[model samples]
Target: MRHVIALDVGGTAMKAALTGLDGTPLYEERRGTGRERGPEAVVESVLRFAEDLSVLGRERLGTAAEAVGLAVPGIVDAGRGVAVHAVNLGWREVPLRELLGRRLGGVPVALGHDVRAGGLAEGRLGAGRGTGRFLYVSLGTGIAGAIGIDGAVEAGSHGRAGEIGHVVVRPGGPACGCGGRGCLETLASADAVGRAWSAASGDPDADAADCAGAVESGDPVALRVWQEAVDALADGLVAAVTVLDPRVVILGGGLAEAGDTLLAPLRAAVAERLTFQRLPALVPAALGDAAGCLGAGLLARDLLAALAVRT
Candidate 1:
């Protein structure tokens, strides 16, 4: 069977899949990124992970992988196969695709931004399928987005197109890692919600899911915190809708997992705030955690197609 190696590397974990040509998984696995061990170790782990997947494909499926696709966090230069910067992984200007390819016997490698790859999968095979234009917002530890047009996710010039998290939603609200005050992520991301809830509930380990549970049980404190986060999220999303005018906005990540608790209020708030811009249908992500892996497979397939065309 013809197969490709697909990998999605996150802050602490890496999800990988050996996939058939039609995007069906032949093998899937998860492992730590070893980021705590430092950047060099993390890079070594990624290369080893790809090689292991390739070997597994050959042994189990009786075919060598034709290509490899990788989706990684931070600022990425996909066209140049470089991971420009990732604060969590301590990477800067790393030639990931080139390195992985050399380790895999010169097999073709397709590299992309993790969120953009997820958006690609969403546009082709998940919630945004058939939607000509949409925004994929991931409300995880930090917020990020991908602008999907037709079947492709736009990477923008300088590879920072869909960074909605840094958009200032509250003036002088909170400090952001991006050196901005009152950015959307600082107020509304999963990590942000967790921090607020923990401080209010006096549970040092409390997270966003706990906040959602409290909201469901009608806790006044939780409600206040949740509502504040939702309002800020709507502000940032409204800005995106006004500028991009997407047909729909697909929400994913840990915070979005709250389901209706998050979506219901978000929809209402965004609707109330809208003036002349068209309201976008806000929907939950269909693929969940698998979107990035599936998207990596798609990228691999696209690379094969382009190579074949050239020949």
Candidate 2:
């Protein structure tokens, strides 16, 4: 079977698949990124993982992968195929595309920002499909965003186009890892909600899911925390909507797993904030965690298409 290797490298784990030309998964697997062991180890693990998948594809399907796609977090220089900086992974200016290409015997490779890759899948195959213009926001350990136009996600001139997380919603609020104060992620990310709930509920282990349950059960403290996060998200989103004017906004990531608990209030909050800007339809991402992996497959397929055109 003709297939491509697709990998989504997350902060903690890597999701990989041998994907068919039509985007169906022929084989799927997961492995820890081993970031705790250090960035070098993580890079080795990723290479080994991809090499293993390629071998597996050859053994099981009687063919080698034609291309590879990698989606990673933090700043990316896609044109250069380098992962510029990922604070979570503690790496700098890694030429992942070149490294992977060598590892895979010079197969073509496409490197992209993880969130942008996910948004690409959303725009073409998930919630934002057929929307023409949309924004994808992920509220996970930290927030990030991707702006989708037509069927593709914009990487900006510097590959930092849709960074809604760093938008300061509250002046002089919590400090952000991006070296900014009061960034939206500081107040509205899943990690932020979990920390606030942990403090309020007096349980150091309480997280955003626990907070959502408490809100459903009518816990006043949880309600307050949820509302605060929602309000901050609304502020940041309004700022984005004002400038971009997307036709739709797709929300994803861990915090979005709370579903309507996060969406209901968030919709109201954003609606209340908007005045002159057109209200874009807010929706949940349809592909869930699989979006990034599927998107990587799409990237590989796109690379193959471009190569064929050149030939």
Worst 10 residues of 1 by lDDT: 18-27
Residue pairs with backbone atoms closer than 3 Å in model 1 (clashes): none
Error of 2 at 143 (Å): 0.3
Runs of candidate 1 exceeding 4 Å displacement: none
- Compose the digit string of candidate 1's lDDT tens values, residues 102-218: 999999999999999999999999999999999999999899999999999999988899999999999998999888999999999999999999999999999999999999999
Candidate 2 residue lDDT tens string, 113-218 = 9999999999999999999999999999999999999999999998889999999999899999999999999999999999999999999989999999999999
lDDT of 1: 0.96
Which stretches in model 2 have alpha-carbon errors above 4 Å?
Answer: none
TM-scores, all candidates, are 0.98, 0.98
For each candidate, the alpha-carbon lDDT, in order, equals 0.96, 0.96
